[model samples]
Target: MKHEFDSAFHPADIAFKTLKLAPHAWVPNNSRLPVLIYRRAVDPSTKDLGKTFEALLAGNEWLPQWRDSIFDYHHFHSTAHEALAVISGKAEVIVGGPGGEVVSVAAGDVVLLPAGTGHCLQSTEGRFQVVGAYPEGQQWDIRRDALLKEEIAAMEALPFPRSDPVAGRKGPLLQEWT
Candidate 1:
């Protein structure tokens, strides 16, 4: 669907929730990666939700991303924050760690994972697809439930992105994370 605010989309129009985390066995010691969820951010009637979501992220400076399905196992990125926008189908995702919370997400939903926040695809419907990306110039390091001391330190030292993947520099992402 088209919106009058499309040219001047305000962050206030979008409702976001944050998930705080503590250092787990596999995850490292650092500020709880802010988990921001934007529900129904896209219009269901819109075709090609994947490309649209990618464009939104890219516009906000979350670049060098990929389009694919989420892995059905627990994993975390110690080096960079990640954003996942559900383009099609539905799935249950575990966030924060193996014992983290399970969230049911579908098309038009967006999830922002801070560095070191563990996530996995618990279950999925027929065709689950997500568009994933990172902040400009950031590469991803995959880590399961294990980490070395230096790895933990590096994760703790990782910098927050200047802008939100979905929102811009003045979005809720910066407000909650920084």
Candidate 2:
């Protein structure tokens, strides 16, 4: 029996270029992470969190970062299942669980975390990149400070409403989410 491996197969090199040779650009401040927005180069139809339950369950993986910057949690998938494929770059994927290890996933490495896992990413040296997947019905939960900033900016941009709810206009509703 004979097996064949590509002559140019280097784990580090492979990781660095998996998502290379593709058109990439700087993400603007207003733009959220491409993964959560479904704007990355991958198949958007298949990447929806709600419909692609199997991918979420089976724990699909991919390059999670690129050559420039890491994806921001506020811009990435929120409250959804996820898997990661580390082709290159250096980073961490910390999920919530007992003995949840902060695995050092690098080139030719794979890791899977359960749904609703809080994610924070940072790049080492150059740009860090990885492939990732998530379940649907996900939302970006803004931090308390970030939410306050947005609310304040929004309020400053507009005149106060006639009903002034925040100004002690008690309504019939108790809690919104409930």
Candidate 3:
């Protein structure tokens, strides 16, 4: 089979050729500017985003590393299930539970959270490359730093993550809050 390259290429062909697979290693420019190498067009082929689920690319948005201190630490909600697929570079995916317990995720890893769960990220290496998803009617509720700090304190006060084994606790082994 021979494939021809055209300035006017179809999405299906492109997605297929790339195997629609996550990048082997998530490497981003030193500036942390995300590069949109590929994106799944919203068309008839891909319309359904099951209940409490969504899929969208987190395109590289211009942000001054020095000036943009917005994404320091926060937890947002996406009415529906949320998934972040690492395309390149190392990113720290912190999936926080009712308590302070957090599960740490690394590059080339896909982190999924139930609807209304608390999740956030702090780029540990390179630029953060991730594809985020939300339920049909869900919009990202980005919490402010002050709010996040309060939540962290609230969660820590109560022994939650440590109380339950089922609670999904992942993120950096030890994050300094002070």
- lDDT comparison, 1 vs 2, better candidate: 1
> What RMSD does each model have against the real structure?
3.7, 18.9, 16.5
Off by over 4 Å in 1: 1-12
List ranges where model 3 is wrong by over 4 Å.
1-70, 97-99, 143-178
Candidate that scores best on lDDT: 1
Q: How many residue pairs clash in each candidate?
A: 0, 15, 12
User: Please, what are the lDDT tens digits per residue for candidate 3 over residues 1-178?
Assistant: 2122222212233221111111111210011111111222223232342211121222211111111111445454422234454444454443342222233333333343433344445446665454454323334455322233454344234221111001112111011111
TM-scores for candidates 1 onward, in order: 0.89, 0.32, 0.36
Q: Write the per-residue lDDT of candidate 1 for residues 40-77, one digit (tens) a residue.
A: 77764469988888888898889737888888888888
Q: Kindly provide the TM-score of model 3 when superposed on the true structure, using C-alpha atoms.
A: 0.36
